[model samples]
Target chain A: MSSEGTQPLGRARPQETPAVAAPLLRRGMGNLATVAAHLVLMTWTVFVAFPFLWMVVTSFKTDQEIFFSPWRLPSALRWENFARAWTDASIGRYFLNSLIVVTGAMVLTLLCASMTAYALARFDFPGNRILYYCFLAGLMFPVFLALVPLFFVVRDLHLVGTFQGLIIVYTAYSLPFSIFFLHGFFRSLPGEVAEAAIVDGASPYRVFFDVMLPMAQPGLVAVGIFNFLGQWNQFILPLILMPNPDRYVLSQGLAFLAIQRGYESDWSALFAGLTITMLPTLIVYVFFQRRVQQGLTVGALKG
Target chain B: MHHHKYRLIIPFVLPSALIYGVFVLWPYAQALYFSLTRWRGFSRNRPFVGLDNFERMLDDRLFWNALEHNALMLVVLPSATVALSLLFSALIAQGGRGLRGAEIYRIVSFFPQVMSAVVIGVLWSFVFHPNIGVLNGFLRVIGLGSLQRTWLGDPQWVLWAIALVAVWSSVGFFMILFIAGMQSIPTDLYDAATVDGASRWRAFFGITLPLLRDHLQVAFVFMGLSALDLFALVQVMAENGGPSRAADVIARYMYDLAFNKSQFGYATAIGVVLLILSLVLSVLVVQLTQRERIEF
Candidate 1:
């Protein structure tokens, strides 16, 4: 920008009325430019959204219809593909596995992170500074680099291929960001209410649970949505740790279905499986769309 | 009384400390030791051979090939995604009042951000399918059939094709980020520029981009790290790292060595290399993109 031969912001004139001022990108008005921008945006909209739409549409078509008329609407709305994918393949089971692990991990991650964050934020104690920074450092380390030793650690603890193993590992991996974000939330709280509760003969735990916990809910929800997406969409960890066929998460199960699709050629069922995997995230994102984006962007900027 | 304070603090801090210690910290520490040993994963015959794996990796063709692919991605993904995202953000959120259909476009574009990488990889794999695939089918319909290729299967275009998908899925997320960054800048900065006869393009260069430099730097680091460790997408999209290892990356190759080939020691060496490269590259990115701070 400095090299672009333009007036710098310091040289910017005082604000003028909208009618007097030519707003950024609004001057030299051309219907052609606006139309061109809309055209390009629409093209990208299709590029991004069409794949998911086609996944849903193709799921309703029969194999012949899919192969011959890829763009045509399904000749019939055969719900059989959904049923077959759900029952015959393992999508249904994997969906439940993902649900269990992700929910379990989220609860634990929030619990440990909140308690730890509260202590680090509100107290002046020895080793607190060192411990907080230690937790924060986890955000930088690449998880896959630890894959080999991580597998061995899980195996030694007899948690090599179990749900509990995944729940704990996911929680541990989630702690750094959770603690970091929640520390800010906990620190920003007014101390008077917590002190008043403490003076009224409440223990620290009681004070935290009754007063402080409720106050930290917004931060919890933000980090909760953030961790939920990370855990649900997790792949490489489960690939190594949860090798048992029955315990496959949705991502793994979808990948398994895709590889098998090449042999079985049940393209419709594969589409159905992918569409099924997409549904829960779509619903969650739509519901908590604002919080999710805010949390993710904040995480990147802060971390 | 002094001990009583620790009584409360210890309980709160211990659980996180324990969980983080065993799972995240311990394994990372052990990886250093494991990288120097030669063993097949199961037994305890891990006799140490210091730096042998590193020596082997230095000479290994596959390691070099994979590193080259990662380097290529490191360059391509960030630049393409950033350039497209910056333009889209400006157009969509122009002067604090967007163009028509801006809301729908903003919401719809962010949809892919929520979908799992495996779903994206699987879905796009079909989109690039050669025969009845959407891409080839569209090409034929548009009378550009000669331009169609078996995108994933073709070695010449496999890496770029997959890179295109990465850019496709990620541009929206970064665009949203840029829009957020844009909103934080004082509106009068743009207004002032506009009132001074600066053209729209000139105002963007002088104001919007300079103010958005911080977000831009972070995005570059995030993208570069992703390029370094694109294991999940490549695993789901390409079979065995594509034809002749054209799409192979360091992380995927490391997975093959450890799990598939039983070369745990060698794989750990590659993983160590990956860890070092990521650390170095992120530092390099921040350093290269550094400019004189323009505090508003």
Candidate 2:
């Protein structure tokens, strides 16, 4: 209850200190209230995780088992469902398409966004503020607004339904956020490092690539993951631009599978396809949960 | 040095600017032009029809319905998501007691944010699938069978059902944001409140809520923007707007107009309206949230 004790908690360990104070404040609420809080948290955790768990479990169940025992665990591991989804169902093709486009877009976005961010952060130039605002303005304008004209633009370039086209669109669409997020990181970097490198006769390009880009690795990773998740999961843009089924990305392919539910098909493969579509992002998220969370929240809160 | 700095800046900035221009800015400018012309997106020849597309949009009942659906989502999604997120964040932050295992719960709750909206939509559509859906099965098992309804199929329930999915998908994110926001609040305020015999609710309303205004504002605006952009979910889950176009949102309607019906000019008008709406909301959010930052 002392000011002396609580002031330190306020300045240090912003994410951790609140936990130390919360329970004491809520002590009068007693064990039952605490238990109720736990219960609510656990229930929502289950609610959020269950659909994903269901997708994975259902992928291994036969149609009859899925229909008859919707809640029950699958009786056997049906690995073939994934096989079917991969081979016959074309989820494999879609997965490969996604891998190509997501990687291409992520790399392109990182390179360009970092370059732009570095310029805006480090250099003094005309139109710098205008260019920065131009990118930032893209944050509010939904891609749907650009869908029509963007479609025609890509079509006119003869890149429609091509990986290169989707890559360009995704890269362009993602640049706003990537540049905005990276600009902050670049601005925060000690100017002395870049200045010393430049004085050592490192060209501006070399100072950027050799010195600054590596220094901005964390920023790059955050923006990279952000653009990766976004481009991988994009549906509407691909749906419009990539009309060929052969070029369908994972999201577009999954939607295609869902819409084709009325056709005669293996329900298990469909579920497996859904699982296949979700696994890469989920696995990446599990590994880099902190970075992914930071990426998403930063884009929303700060950028 | 100054001239060199300026020259170098162009190389660094040009790639991003060019790509962004060709793809984003140019398309948007074309959207303006196309909105004025009575042109099908595919073929070139078209007469100029100034304001006609916008006029048609004003008269279109379906556009209004779709906009209304988006407005509903804009209100419901952010409120429900932020509310539940605030509660969950508070619970998870109550770490001194039995709720010590906050990390797992936090991670698990955020599991949905990592997945594609298309995947979430497909997954939830199956979860809400009529006969074999897990929701209905669980309802039946709980003997609440009569309460179960065709969630996405019925017009009355479709929007709510989609909104619920959105809330589920979104809560973890906002929860994380609020948790971060709350952590930055000094523990002294809570201590003072405790000494004053202020109840937990009172401390929350007076101390926590006011301090967290900036975070809440950001969350609301971001979530609102998302609410407007529900193309993937609506397209995948509700089958491009459920029965009677009940769950149809502006983005999906624009897609249908551009792609399905080939009403390119009209669709561009819809897109312009969508742009205007988003810009308006964003400006409003900035204006609303621009209260003097509380330094504490």
Candidate 3:
């Protein structure tokens, strides 16, 4: 980079002397730049991954090792930490609960949001634009903003502690992004096939179910995985609504274990619980990394 | 055709509409109403008290303090995330031509984005644990033992500790966003800049930043909202606002008010304030960043 001004490339273009030298200088700087860039990137990668690594390693250590030999590698696998987390710590129950709610919420949110997205994208009905914007508006309504009234709404229906209530909340919360994302997909889809289906005297519902919905499968998968990760990781709603120990989701469960066990000698068990709670989403992310990343950008960019 | 429109629209839209309305819209409207009432969490015969809650919030020190923390977050979080993201994305994008491992680095950096905030909070708490923590241990390893402090326990360090986690978790997502933005910039412009003797830094400021206005706006809005909704971190890490309410933000405070103290009405007022604050910030961000797209 420092050698740019004196390089022969600068003498070639007198009109823009500095401009002519830049490419050559950049070429020379490339090697040094790559090393520097890698240094920064590697440092950040370590910064990002080290905690997770520490969490896993710490989970394998006994209480004494964690407290005393914090930096040392565990001598044994200590798989029983996981057992303690799953059974005595109750993360297993919470994991099961999370799976049920997230699955139900994913399916229901996809169903409702996609159907609405399809309508808004395909049909020119009265209030179509209005309805689309209304769903879009849901994006701004953070869960905390409606916590008090929503608690009352759920409690009034006598579903406060029920999975059904949480599922409903998750579905509603996930709808805005789902609809917005799928709306773009539904709109971009070729209208020719769906038009032909309509011309064949197929019912509107049948056309959607049989034809357009299938065509929107990619979008569905994108939104489905997005909703799944979101619902799986949800904390605030479950924390407020599911006070019952039996019904705690993974996030709430992990938090509970952290607080309850933080003061005890059960630190490794807490780490184990954190690891278990993080596993599903981590697997999903690792497997479907591209799709997950794209889904995140799709909502932000498209909206 | 007109009749068919309504037939298809109603069925397709009703399910989502009803759920969204009942869960989101109705509660929001009810929040607006509840903000004006003197109802406790369980009371049915709530009496109307117009603007009293808002008036109380005005005089509430804890509310103001929480708001101040949130305001600090709103300022610091997005700026840090955007700056770091831009730096990382630029390196990955330009990377001095053929920088190896950009793809791997990108993937690795995004690891935290996949985990839940609760997990991040728990893991960070362990990282900041005074005796057993990696951070303090590292400080001691490097002979900087005096610098090691209780990160989340000290009221002074707690908010910064939480903000660091926020930045850590979010930097990759925004980096991905900026990478997309940077990649879309026509390479010929950079080539031209190179040919014109512009330095990499000059090209970045002159060419890259101007084109990434839209992505920056998106980042600002998203990070701002995340800042305002920072409950999981503070809750799990600091054990609800940390020492002396040093790290308390609006969302956690509202949660405590409603759930802990049963001050449903007061909490609703806080929620309303948060809602309006978020809405205002969002609109302002959009308006502030609204500029004509420079077509390449």
RMSD of each: 4.4, 3.7, 6.5
Q: Summing lDDT over every window of 10 consecutive residues in candidate 2 chain A, give the lowest-scoring window.
A: A1-10
Model 3 lDDT tens row, A1-303: 112211222221122223322353455656777688789989999889899899999889898898878789998999999999999999899999998998899889988988899989988867889888888887767677789889888899898999999999999889898998888789889989988998999988899999999999988998888788778888989988898999999889888888889777598888888888888888898998867876776556665
Q: Pick the candidate with the highest TM-score.
A: 1
What is candidate 2's fraction of native contacts?
A: 0.69
lDDT tens digits by residue: candidate 1, B1-296: 56766777899999999999999999889999999999885788999999999999888999999999999999999999999999887776663333556766777887788777888999999899886589998898889989999999998988998899889988888877777666656667867887798877787888878778777887898899989988888897777899999999999999999999888888988889888988998888677657435232
Clash pairs, model 1 backbone:
none
lDDT tens per residue, model 2, A98-209:
9999888888888889888988987776788999999988876777778888988898899998999989888999988888888888988988988898788888788888
lDDT of 1 by residue, A90-154 (tens): 89999999999999999999999999999899888989999999999888889877999999899
Model number 3 iRMSD: 7.8
Q: Lowest-lDDT window of 10 residues in candidate 3 chain B?
A: B287-296
Clashing residue pair totals per candidate (backbone < 3 A): 0, 0, 3
lDDT of 1 at B168: 90
Q: Candidate 1 chain B — worst ten consecutive residues by lDDT sum?
A: B287-296
Where is model 1 more than 4 Å wrong at Cα?
A1-22, A25-29, B95-98, B292-296
In model 3, which regions exceed 4 Å deviation? A1-27, A199-201, B1-7, B291-296
Relative to the true structure, how large is the alpha-carbon lDDT of every model?
0.84, 0.82, 0.84
Better of 1 and 2 by DockQ: 2
Error of 1 at A125 (Å): 0.9
